[model samples]
Target: MNRFDAIIIGAGPAGLTTALVLAQAGKEVVVLERGEYPGSKNMFGGVLYSKGLHELIPHFWDKAPVERPVARWVISALDKEASFSLDYKNARYTEAPYNAFTVLRSKFDSWYARQAEAAGATLLTETIVEDFIYDQQRVVGVKTGREDGELYADVVVAADGVNSLAARKGVIKKDLSPDDVSLGVKEILAMPAESINRAFSLTGNEGAAYTFVGAATQGIPGGGFIYTNKDKLSIGIVVKLSSLSKTGRRPEDLLEDFKQHPMIWPLIKEGEIREYLAHLIPEGGQTSSKSLYKGGLLATGDAGGFTLSTGFRVEGANLAIMSGMAAAETIKRSSRSRDFSEKGLSIYPDLLRQYGVLADMEKFRHAPNFLKNPRLYQSYPELVCQISNALFSVEPGPKKGIGEMVKEARKGKQLSRFEIIKDIYAGWRGLA
Candidate 1:
C-alpha cells in the first residue's frame, strides 16, 4: 500500500485546494480522481469568486484560465410574456483582484490540479475509490478499483461532491433527502468573441452574470443562470429534486423552454451549443451540514453541503476552497501531533467557524426554506410583470392608480395582500 500524510478523494476545486494546501505545508498528499483528468467530470455555473483562490494562490488570475471578469450582474423575473430585470455594473470588478470571474471547469480544474502537482502533491486520475480500508473503525486508507490500489494515509478528506459515497458510508452519519439536492442542467453555447461582446455590449474582457426566476424554471422551485465565458455562454437551470419530481418536467425540457424565452433568446440567438451536462448540487443549508468531521475523516465542499443558494446569489466554489483549506490546516496540526483520532481532527469545524464558512452557513440557514416558496418562483414574477404592463400601457380611456393596477393583476391569480404580506414577513425572517 502506498502511504501518505493525507489522501483526498475527488479533484474538484475542494479536493485540489486541499491537496495544494497540505502539499505546500510539506505534507505528503495524494488526490485520487475518477475522471480522465481533474475537471473532466466537473461542471458549474462558471463563476469563481476570488476571495478563496486569492488566499491559496495570490494573483492567480494573472496565469489561470480565467474567462472574463464580471463587471455587471443582472437579476430578472420572467413571465410568459414580460420580464422585469435589475442590472448593476461597476468598474471596480474589472480592476485588480476582481470580485468574480467566469471559468470553464474543465480548463480551470486541469490548471488547478497542475498547480497542486507543482507543489509536490501526487495526483492520480482515472482512479475510483470504491470504499475505505478501515482499521476497525477509523479510516486509514482508501480501496481503489485498480490492482493493489489500497493507499494508506493518516487522514482522508471526502471532497467528492453532493452524492459523496464517503459521506454515505457512515463517515458523516447523515442521509441526503430528495429535498436537499438540486439537479442542475447546463448547455455551453459557443460564438465568436466579437459576437459575444456585441450581444452583451461588453468592451475588452468585461463580462456579465444573469440570474432568472419565474418562467425560467416553469415556475418551479429553482432558478436559471447565464454566465459568459470568452467566446461562449454557460446557461443552465437548477431545481429542487423534490419539486422536479412533482412537476413531471425533465430538466432538459425546462432548459429548452428557458432558452426560448423572449428576453433570453436574443442573447444567444446565433450561438451554437457545444455541450450539455447534468449535475447534482447540494442545496440543503447549514442544518444539513451535521458532523463534518468524524474520526480521521472530514467532509468538505458539496459533500458537506457547503453550497449556498441565496435568492439573489448562488455561491459554492469560494466556500469549497475555504473549507478545503480549513481541512488542510486541521490535518497539518494532526500530523504534527501524530494523532489522527476524532478528537485530534475536531479542530476542523473550529477552523471552519474561524474562517467564516460556518458563520455564512448559519447566517443563510433559512435560505433553503425561504427559497422553497412557490410564490417567489411563480406568482410574484407574474405579478411584477402584470403591474409593470398596467403601469406603462397608454390606455384609450382613464388610467388606473398603482393600487388599482395591483388589484387588477391579482384578481384572477387568487393571491391576496395577506398572503403577500405573509411571504414578505417570512422572507424577511429567513433571508434578511
Candidate 2:
C-alpha cells in the first residue's frame, strides 16, 4: 500500500479542491473517485458562483469550460395563467471578475481535476473507497473497491457529496427527512443560437436565469429554474421530497406541468430536448446532521451538506470549493505541527466559521420553512398571472377598473388582505 499525507474521496468540486490546495502546499495527496471520469456521475441545475472560487484558482474564468456569463436574473411568482416577475441586470459583471457563469458538471469537474493533477496530486478514478481503515480510534486510510486496493494516508478528507461514507456509523448521525430533500429534474434543450438569443432577449455570451415559485412545482415546495446556455437551455424544477412522497406525483409529470406553463411554454417552443437528468439535493443543510471532524478525518462539500438556499438564491458549489480548500489548508497546517488528531482537526470547523460559511447559513435559517409555504406554490403565482390578464383584457363592452380587477383576482385566489400583508412580511423577513 502506498502511503500519502492525505487522501480525498470523490473528485467533485470539494475533493478536487482539497487536492489542489494540499498539492500546492507540497503535501502528497491522493483523490480517490468512483466514476470512470471525474464528472461522469455528477449533475447539477447549472449555475456557478465565481466568488469563493476565484479565491482558489485565480483568473478561473479564462480556461474553465463554462457555458455563459449571466446577465439577467429573474424571480417569479407563478399562477395558473400568468406570472409576476422581478428582473435585474448589471453590466458590471460582464468583464473580468465576473459575478457568475453557467457550466455543465461533466466538463467543469474534469477541468478542475486537471488543475489538481497539475499541482502533482495523484487522481485515482474508477476507484471507490468501500470503508475506512481505522487504527483503534482514528481513520488511517481507506479500503477501496478494486482488488488488492488498500491505501494508507495519515489523514482523510471526505468530499463524497450528500451520501458520504465518512458520514457512516455514529460520526454523523443525521438521516435526511423527505422535507429536507428536493428532487430536481433538468433537460438540455438545444436550439438555434439566434432563437435562443431572441427568446431570452440577450446578445453575446450573456445568459439569463430564473426561479419559478408557483405552478411549476404543482403545489410542491420547490422552484423551477431556467438557464440559457450558448445554444442550449437548462430548464428544470426542484420539488421537496415530502411534497412528492405525499402527492405521489412523479418527477416527469411535474416536469411536464412546468413546461406546459403559459409562461414557460413560449420560451421553449421549437426547441428539442437533448438531455434529461434527475437528482436529489439536500436543502436543509448539515447544521445538525453531522460532526465535521474526528481524529485524522474531516468532511467537506455535499458530505457536510453545506448548500445554502434562500427560496431562490443557491450556494452549493461555492461552499464545496471553499470547504475543500479549507480542509487541505488544515492538513498543511497540521503537517507543520506534526499533529493529525481530533484536536488538530478542530481547525477545520474554525476555518469554515472564520471564512463565514457557518455564519451565512445561520443568518438565513428561515429559508426552509419559507419554501414550504403552501400559498406560494398553490395560489400566489396563478393569481398574479390572472391579475395581469384581467388588467390587460380588451373587453368589448367595458373595462373593469384596475383596482377592481386586482381585488377580484385576489378574491379568486382565496387571499385575504391580512394574508397578503402577512405573506409579504414572512417572506421578506425569512429571506432577510
Encode model 1's per-residue lDDT on 213-272: one tens digit a residue.
Answer: 999998898899999899999999989899999989989999999999988999889789
User: Compared to the true structure, candidate 1 yields what TM-score?
Assistant: 0.98
Which is the leading candidate under TM-score?
Answer: 1
Q: How many pairs of residues collide in model 2?
A: 6
TM-scores of all predicted structures: 0.98, 0.94
For model 1, which pairs clash?
none
Q: Ten-residue segment with the worst summed lDDT in candidate 2?
A: 167-176
Tens-place lDDT per residue, model 2, 327-393, is 8788888888988888877788778876666667777777666767888787787777787888776
Q: Count the backbone clashes (under 3 Å) in each candidate.
A: 0, 6
lDDT per prediction? Answer: 0.89, 0.84
